[model samples]
Target: MSNSDSSTTKTNGDQFARKGMSNGHASGMGHATVEIQDGKTVVMDDGRKPPLAIVLKFVDVKHTVAIESRFSWSAKRPFQFKRQSAMEKEILHGITGSVMPGEVLAIMGPSGSGKTTFLNLMGGRALRGMSGNITYNDIKYNKALKRRMGFVTQDDVLFPNLTVRETLMYAALLRLPNSLTRSQKIKRAEDAIIELGLERCRDTVIGGPFLRGISGGERKRVSIGHEILTDPSLLFLDEPTSGLDSTTALRIIQVIKNIAQAGRTVLTTIHQPSSRLFYMFDKLILLSEGHPVYFGKANGAMDYYASIGLKPLIAMNPADFLLDIASGNVNDVSIPQELDKSALPNGNDEAIQPPAKDVREYLVNTFNQELAPQERAKLFALESTREELKLAISEKRLWSITWTQQFSILFIRGLKERRHEFLSWLRFVQCIAISLIVGCLWWRSKIQTEAQLSDQAGLVFFIAIFWGMFPLFTAIFTFPLERAMLAKERASDLYRLSAYFMARTLGDLPLDLVMPCIFILIVYFMTNLRVTAAAFFLTTLTVFLDVVTSQGLGFLIGAVMMDVKKATTLASIVMLAFMLTAGFFVQHIPVWMKWLKYVSFNYYVYKLLIKVQYSDGEVYDCGTGCQSVGTSPSFHGIQLGGGGMEAWALLLMVAIYRILAYIALRRMKTGG
Candidate 1:
């Protein structure tokens, strides 16, 4: 490899880059040569200029992948669904190309040519509808690698709550080893801050409709920093410079070029690069109608255009030039056929190396050809296994952080977030005050007669419904906001999802106890229920169970759905079913629906309230055959001690729901 001529030899991933490109591999490229006079630039074909750098490499597909799609309703409305029936139109036409390790490989095509689809395939974000052999460093496309490879999605997916530094730090901690001490992590985070030039406003907060965080550039840099923190070998950014000014865009390309020069691969799907950015790339891949028009070194890309009798103007983006050619926007220029060898520069006649048909075999042969047998054996010798790293990651999380950690963090964050919104807190306080005031207005109003008892039952029924819906309010509010951050951390394998769930569950206990405790205490005391110290405790316990169970239900919904609107819809359905089966208005429901009562959390909660409040005596009148409202004669076929056992069963039901919610929360976590 070292013995190759200067025109063919390229640098390995060693040493930093100088201004412009250090290699002279662009000698064969006619459009790459430039001249400078008194700091003014001029396009020239002198053949002595530097070649552009290569930032990434895509060798070849190792296996054939068959992609298929089907539709069920196409025949019913063929005209309406003709286009819809074929969701996938085979965008990438099984093209083969390689990008250099430090080059920006531009992928340009028309709107429907599958540019985004190709980018998604490269990023491993495509679903089962599409299939293809994608390899990185000769390894088949793996999702784990995608984690290390950052994809700046078309939309800037930034959390508006955190500052720029906080956002990057969180991403860093999640991706890097936790074994490093706090200071070490901070240093690493600081390094990224400096590299992306975000130090000016490191603590600037991001902004959104309800959130204020950082500037756009800072957010984008933070996104870039996240991928860099993992020391990723490759990066796939989609339209990174979009929505930015021309100057900012050029600067961003320069930064990316610097990043590539630092021995990492950075491939971005850009709309159009300025001339400056165009010169920054090492390769160009042009596509039309899902077919490759050209795939080669960037400097040589224009040469292919010139070969087809087309002359591109200076300072024009290569993508724009190619598009013009494809769309017939420019007159074609002709290439000299026979006299080019002698007429061109001396180095342009050098042979072009053929691309490897089998990347693995090529690499193997290269390795074998480069080293002696003894050196090859030594290189293959194993020093330490990846199991050690996994174990180390596991060990850092072995510390027994009790429920205290989760409860404390969640409670604090919840309070902070709730308070920051201000409107929600005011509404919540107002509702509690109003509910208490309403209960007081109806205090000691009845329970002496059947109609009076029915009113009391109505009150209890409303309370049960309210409690069942409590978690729904919270889950909808909190989950959507925090889900993105949690997902980012989980994708980096920060900690066990179980630990996060446990912490959240435990942390909310105190706040959960306080809020409902106050509400229940106010209503229980003011409404003039038979209030003994034991009765007060019992009622408070029931309210607490109600709130916790609601929270658990909400957590499960939020965790699974991630979308607040959908979660609310689902929670509403559950609440409605529980209300119907909970003996609200129906003493006898259908047998099938009766089975739902067993699983209905509202049923247990409301039934237990009746047993606790009215168990001692219901003031029976003249053998009128009083049936206690919301009471079950038997639970699991065992009569209550005046049904005190029923209260215990309700408690058990709450516990079970809490457990199931925890499981759901854990499953919602990212990496796990």
Candidate 2:
């Protein structure tokens, strides 16, 4: 061969060798050889046997999640302060199972059967009372292992304003490792969208109660896509198909099956799946009343029931039959005496001998005797393989991004979400409309009379109340509506709680400032209050500060109560109390109740406005005589501090309320 031809051949051979080496390493092979046989290239591996690849196209891989849990809870003792009582009911009782990669494990149970609780335990999201031992591929479950897993909650808690792509991209940014570059993160999010069949609605907004957006199924897929952005090895989904139609539900399960087939461990809670969907599950965990009725192969469930002398009627769906047995609706069926004596695989007769009374007892006894030992043995075998395998555990931080990155991403996301909320637009419109109405009502007020001065003061006080009460009441629903989403994300350790709280506070500030500006601009010029540029700007500043302070109050209530109704009711009561004692309505206060006004934000705000307008030696003409309004009877003993001092005081209140809200958010528990 010529020199150039020989060099070319050598280069081709080197490329083949590199490809073989990469494949060999991925399959856990120590060495590989590329050979030319029969004019064709062949790759041979010489090392330990390779694991069964998820499919011919995917690499050889395996991941197993084994969990054993017994959980219960404590409750507050009625009418007893600082006292607690442990509930007699058990949430889970010695539940044990193992889910392996390349398979789907379906957890099914009737309502209140601890299905969700068990899933939560496995996902490391269980409440404080949970007691469990969970291991991922022989590594004990911890924050590190949690990083390699994905959790999709039952409720599709997504940002209603963002498109499907934006939602996944943000999730990718927050959840993916720092090792991935921006382009890689974007690509991963795109891949997840295509993988979950969300391309059709990639740019579609995830709509909520008021916004027009994606369908329920599409939203559900987006939620799933959010978790899968990092391509986690293990995925846990809670009722993923819960409100979806049969076709969409089957499609979701199929996509999930495809994910498992791609070498990811998938465990999902399903409620009454169709026959086809039921068979899609590789393993089935049937739970009832906090007890495991069966934990074995999904396809073999019917046969297992037959083995226990409880054969379902022909053509009956296996899932329904299992549910019937779980619910104790099945009639007693006699077992053959000889079969009862037959030794199970574990050399135990417990499987053969049915319980004398409850079906649940019989099923649990049989599973413990016959299947538990085998499952345990399988788990041990899988764990034993880990000793020889070189498993690299990537220790990752709870948050994948830095604090600044989290704040930035979260701030941008919050702004986008708020932009789409109907209430947000409504608040803006309400501010403008109320401003116009108030300006029209107090049109061109002149301080020609002392009573006109009072009227102007009333208008100023009304402005304070409008700006303060509106934002405060509207902001009350902010945290409560998104509490579920917050809990789910926090449970997954996506970001710091402080980061989210701060981002939310800062993100809404721009809009908050803008709305008040529009209101004050229109009303300031029309109402004809102090015409000086300094006075107009000062009034604007005071009103903006007042609105911010009110919003801070809203945040506190929302965070502390975490329920819209309760927070709204509490905020209404508090605002009403503030209004009653604001010094304008009730001039003469009782001795015991005189200090209440000091606690009211409205009182401080009214005082600040009064000082800003009248503190500069302005005069008003009475019908009989002209007098200085600043030194009038209404202003006597009110102590109208300097505008700067009053501004600082309003700012101080804002800071205090915001700090308290942050504290409450930090102390609040996201999930049970």
Candidate 3:
């Protein structure tokens, strides 16, 4: 046999062996060999009984999407004031197409061609100012249909710290139906890993900029594996192979093609594919400046172009050729005077010039007048035949799991992810270093003299500031960095917003407590602020509350900003403002700015710490004299709000800020 045939035979044999091993037949029956010849399973005539074959079953449902739209989407401004000056950009201009079952439709276009926008609109990711009918199997797109569809965005948007298996397992737990047992959900995740050829990296971490982990191709497969774990009837992938090497890109596309062949509708936006990769698409949707230039079979695209007197150069990749045409690179192409331009909208006239139109406009006008009718007829025929098949829509449930279950899963996953960073050796060392520095700064502070008392008061205020500022700044990056992942998951309706917010808040509590406890233990005894254990415990409690409150503020800022740099900038400015009014830097505030203290978390933290340390009413010796602790000389001009009240205020701020964070997350979900 030739080498190619021999390699194929070996591959098949390995697959059978692995299957038998997985089915628990290999160990019991010793060694067995199986093969397929002429589409028939053949077993060797050995004395051993043939091992039972293992067959994996996938959801065989088919979904057809027919979408027609004239839509416009607005760009989101960083500041609301800029929105008034921003203009609405038209994306889709009355484009129409249908994706049938057992077919892979590739949407192709140049930069700013609205290819991704069109796909987002059909996937129900965009709903604003969209005027059109999008139907699945002749029914209007609804929550039920959305639940049955899976959308894979261009960016992977996964937790870099989590392993491949953990990521897919969490996705399965969240997206799969509640009727499925836990073992079945786990089996689904395993099957997805196998299907995506990710068995090797199943336990490898999905690395990001901070850490080295799996290869880019493996990460892409894991992303695909997450979406396919649910086995949705309709799958949408946006730029699935945009950044991979040519070989990896081809492999990814081949997997998608196999998915289509297994009776699912696959729609994807592909850019600048190779000739081999381009041919894998069963149908093509050519878009330019939000208009359809061509919608037909992938192989017939070249013929259609030649019919319009625009043949590509010999041996050119078809995708590259189509992109050139869409980008208006074709020269000397004449626009037919008889072509109908009246059907096109007048609003986008600026996008296309009059008299002699650009290449994209020419193709769009021609397709609408000549080819679209034929495509529409095919969709209509499919619609008419829908009655022949019994199509059952699964009953839609908003959440696949209960609230307690969601919180439990999310807590475990969040804890596992944060444990890698929150308690890292770097963070531990940093905290220890900060503690030693603070200890040495106020080494063995005493209450013997007024200057010493003032020094001790400064130390206490610094402690409050450190705890408040450190955790807040560190936690500010949390939500902004995960915004994309959160948006995608929320769009999928995986869990309730409250469940995620609570789990995230509660998961970080342990780490938040750990750092503050270490800081206080090292600093409190070294400074000798109070000798009593009760006093030290109260001081620690005060600092811990400050940390929690600061973390809550961070969550609010991160959720509201949704951009790491922007949120960090805002947090810095806000923290600086709080510190300035925190009763240490400025003793007597201006009457006009007195209101700043009420909103400042650091102000309350400082007050609570002072109360915990000085509430004993002890006496201190000034440089030249002695004074009572509650006197102005000992306590500095700081107002002694009762420690109990200050602690309650800190707790209230935590609740308020977290509530606001949840609201911001919800607003992000609704596109408010």
Instruction: Specify the highest-lDDT model's number.
Output: 3
Candidate 2 Cα misplacement greater than 4 A, ranges: 1-86, 331-357, 387-398, 422-428, 639-641
Better of 1 and 3 by lDDT: 3
TM-score of 3: 0.82
Q: For residues 93-145, write the lDDT of model 2, one tens digit per residue.
A: 77666777568999998888888888777777763465555666555556766
Each prediction's RMSD over C-alphas, in Å, is 12.5, 9.7, 9.5
- Model 1 residue runs over 4 Å out of place are 1-88, 127-133, 141-148, 312-317, 324-424, 436-440, 443-454, 476-514, 557-565, 617-672
Q: Report how far residue 481 has shifted in candidate 2, in Å.
A: 1.0
Any runs in candidate 3 off by more than 4 Å, and if so which? Answer: 1-89, 331-358, 384-397, 615-617, 623-625, 637-642, 670-672
**Which ten residues in a row are the worst by lDDT in model 3?**
52-61
Tens digit per residue, CA lDDT, model 3, 117-195: 7777777777566776676666555665556677888988899999999999998898877888898788767766765
TM-score for every candidate vs. truth?
Answer: 0.69, 0.82, 0.82
